[model samples]
Target: MRWNRIKRRNVLETGYDCLNGIPLISLRYAIIVAEVLNFHHAANVLGTTQSSVSTRIKGLENALGVLLFERRHRGVRLTEIGRHFVAEVSASIAQIDHAVRTAGAAIDGMEGHLSIGLHSPITAGFLADLRRQYRASYPMIKQSVLESRSSETIALVRGGQLDLAFVVGTVNASDCHSRLLWREPIVAALPLDHPLAKREAITWLDLAGETFLVQHGGTGPQVFERVIRRISERERVPRVHRCDVARDTLMGLVAAGDGITLTTETTTHVPFPGVVFRLIADESESARFSAVWSPHNRNPALLNMLDLATQMSGAASFMETSNT
Candidate 1:
C-alpha cells in the first residue's frame, strides 16, 4: 500500500534522490529479464546465474518502489506498470551507452572534427598524399580545409580559428608549434610562346624584364617577395603585377600572355592549355612547407593528424635518400 502510494507520485517528483541508491547493474538486469521473460534465459544471456539476475531485479523493484514483473509457472510477464517502466529505462540506458561510446571515441581521436588552413594547392605532392592517407586512416574525423595566404593561415592557427595550417616558409609564432614537413622546388608558369619556355629550366635571372603576374591570395604575396629576393641582387627590379585572383585565374592570366607567374612543383600536375611550367634553375630556391598549430590547443584529432604527418614525412625522406 505504501509502495502503491509512492508509485502514484510522478517519477520526476522524487528527482535525483529516488535513483541515488540504485545501481546501474540492477537496471540492466531488469531490462534483460523484461526482454527474455525468463530469469534463467536472461541470466544466460547476461553471463550470470539465474539467482543473481533474480536478486538484481528484486533490488531494482524495491528501489523504484514498484513491481516490475509478475512471476508465473511458465516464466514471468510484465505488469502494466512494468511495461512502461521498462520502455523508459530501455531508451535511457541506450542513450547512456551511446554517450559513453562517443566520449571514448573522441578521447581516442577515432571520432572528432579537424579544420586545416592551407597556402598551397593540394592537387598533388606530399600534402595531397598526406590528406588522402589521413582520411583513409581516420574516416570518422570530419575534416574541413580553407585556402588562404600563408600569413592568414598562420594567423588563423594562432587565433584558434584553425586546428592546423600548412603554410609556405617557417612560422615564427611563440604561441604556436611548427614543424617543417616538406620542401617544394619553385617553378615558373610561363606562356607557351615565352622565349624562356623553350628551355628545360630557367634561372630567376632569365625572368628579368618579364612582367610577373602574382595573385593577392594564397601564396601570391610570398611568391612576390621571393621573386624580389631572388632577382633584386642583379641590380634589376623584377617587374611584378600583383592581381587579386585565385591561383587558377593567375594561371589563366599566364596562358592569356598577360604575365608569367611563379608556383611550386605541385601545381604542374594540372595542365593549362597555353601555360608551361619550368623549374627555377636555382636549386636553392624552394618553398619549405610547415605545419603550424597552437601549443595550448589539445584537440585529439589534431594530435592524430600531426602524428600521421610526422610519420609520412620520415618515410618520404627515407624514400628520397634511397632513390639517391
Candidate 2:
C-alpha cells in the first residue's frame, strides 16, 4: 500500500491504499464545484480546463456512489447530498493544513514542550524574567518548571528526566554541561531585632555563637558550608543548628529569634516578613547560578533556549562594560 505517489513513483508506503488511486485534488475540485455551482467558473478558479474539473468531480462522485450535482438551466448546482459532503471534506482539509503547520514549527524549535528544573529559589529575578520572555515569544511551546535540590536537579538533567536545569554553582558531570547564568551576593538573613541587622554589612564572625539555622539542602545550607569552611582549621567552629524545613520556615525561625540563616541577595525578593537580609562583608561568599543540561539532548526547543541565554548573557556583559 502506497501513501504517496508522484510520476508513477511510490514515495511512501503506509500499508493502506485508502484513497484507491484517487488524487486528493479531486476533493478540491468537488469543493470548488459546490461553491461556484458552474463547471466553467470552477475550472477558471482552479486554473484548469472546464472538462478536467468536470471529470475530476465525476470521478469523486463515482467513487462515493452519489449524485453530487443537479443540472439546471442557469448553471450546475449542488444536490442535497453534495452540500453535506463538501462541508465534511472542507473541515478535514483544514485540520490537515493545521497539522502540517504544527509539524513544521516543531522542526524549527518554535513548538513542542520543555521541562526545566530549578534548584535555587530565584523565582523573582533574571531567571523568572527569562522564562517569561520565552513564553511570550513562543506561546505554542508548553513549559514546566520543576523545583528540587541542587544535586537532584543535576541528576535529573543527566538522566534525561529534565530538558534543562538552573542550579547553584557548577555541576561536575561528564554527561552534562553547565554555564554560569548569574550571581547573587550572599546576605545574612537575621531577625529584624538582631544586632547585626542594624549594621550595613556583617562578617561571618558576627554569626559566631549565633544559632545558625540551615536548610537541609539549598541556598541556606550552601551558605552554612562556606561560612564553616572560611573559619581557621584550628579554631573551634561555632555551634550550628539544622532546620530540615523549607527556606521560608527557616526564615520564620530566624524571625522568632530561634536562629539565624544566610542566603543570596535573591532572597530579598521573596517576602519574608520578620527576616531582614543584609550584605555579607566578605564579597567572596557570593552565590553563583548556572544552567545545566544533558549535552546529548536533541530537543530543538532546548537549543533555542540555550541560544536565548547566550544572547542575553552577551547583552548583559556589553551593558556592564559600557556602564564602567
Candidate 3:
C-alpha cells in the first residue's frame, strides 16, 4: 500500500495536488507546530532542524496556496489564513486530547471489551486465573480470548484484529509494541520410569538418539526445529513425532510414553497417569514469553488487559519459584 495514496474523507484528504503540485504534510506535524508556535521549537519537538520545519511549512503553504503565518519582531504570528488554520488544528488537538483522557479513564473505569490472542501454552495455567480475576473485578467489561500460534497472535495484534497476545520465541516485528512478561527455560518432558526422567536436568545431547514429540505449528515447532538442527551436527535429526493438539493433550501423550517433548517449566502440569519434567542443562536457549500489543489501540479495556496479563505473569512466576 502506497502511503501517498492513503486518504480519509471526513478527517483527512491527500492526493495529487493540481494547483501547487506538492503533497500535503500530515496533521501530526501541523499539531506540533501549532503547539510550539515557533519553527525552531516545533522542529526540536519533532526531532528535525529549524530549517527543515520552515521548509515543510512553506511546502505545506504552497500545497494549499495559503499563507499560514505573519512574521513579527517578537516572533511569527498567525495570519488570517494562519488564524483559521490554527483554530482547526487546535480543535483537532483538543478532540485528540479529550479522546486520550477519556480512553485512559475508561481503562481505569473498567468498561468496554478486550480481545485476547494467545498461544496455547500460556492459556493453560496462570492466564486462566487472570481472566477470572479480571472478570470479577470488572463485571461490566466484556472479554474474548483466542488461542493461536505465537506468529499468528502477533500478526493479529499488529493488524489490530486482537488487542493483546502472549508470544513466545523471537519476534521479528518492528511496528507493534511489546513488553517482557516472563522468562522460563524449556524443560524436557519424559514418561515415568524413563531413563532420563531420573535426572534433575538434561541436555539436548542427553536425548541425542531419543524419539521427540513436537507441537505442529507456531513457535513450538520453530523452537523444536532449532534444537534439532543444532543437535543434528554430528548425527541425524532424532526421530521426531509431531503432534497437533492442545498443551494438555500433548502432556498426556508424553505421559503415555508416546514421545518426549520440550516446553516451558510452568507448562509441566501432568494430568495424565505418568509424566516427569526435567530442566534443560543448556541455559542459552531458554525461551522468553512476551506480552505484545499495538500502540495504536485507543481502547481502554485493552490497556487494562495488558496490566492484568502482567499480574498473571507475576503470579505464575511466584508459583514457579515456589515449585523450584
What does the lDDT read for residue 206 in candidate 1? 87
> Each candidate's lDDT (Cα)?
0.81, 0.74, 0.68
Q: What TM-score, to 2 decimals, does candidate 3 have?
A: 0.55
- Candidate 3: worst-modelled 10 consecutive residues by lDDT: 1-10
Of 1 and 3, the candidate ahead on lDDT is 1
Q: What 10-residue stretch in candidate 1 is worst by lDDT?
A: 1-10
Give a tens-digit lDDT track for model 1, residues 4-50: 22222233223243357886567666777887899999888777899
lDDT of 2 by residue, 98-152 (tens): 6776788999989999999986564676787778888887788899888877778
- Choose the strongest candidate by TM-score: 2
User: For model 3, how does the per-residue alpha-carbon lDDT over 2-54 read when each residue is reduced to its tens digit?
Assistant: 11222222233333432235443445455566656787777776667888778
Off by over 4 Å in 1: 1-21, 41-52, 62-66, 232-237, 315-324
In terms of lDDT, the best-performing candidate is 1
TM-score each candidate: 0.82, 0.85, 0.55
Preferred candidate (lDDT higher): 1 or 2: 1
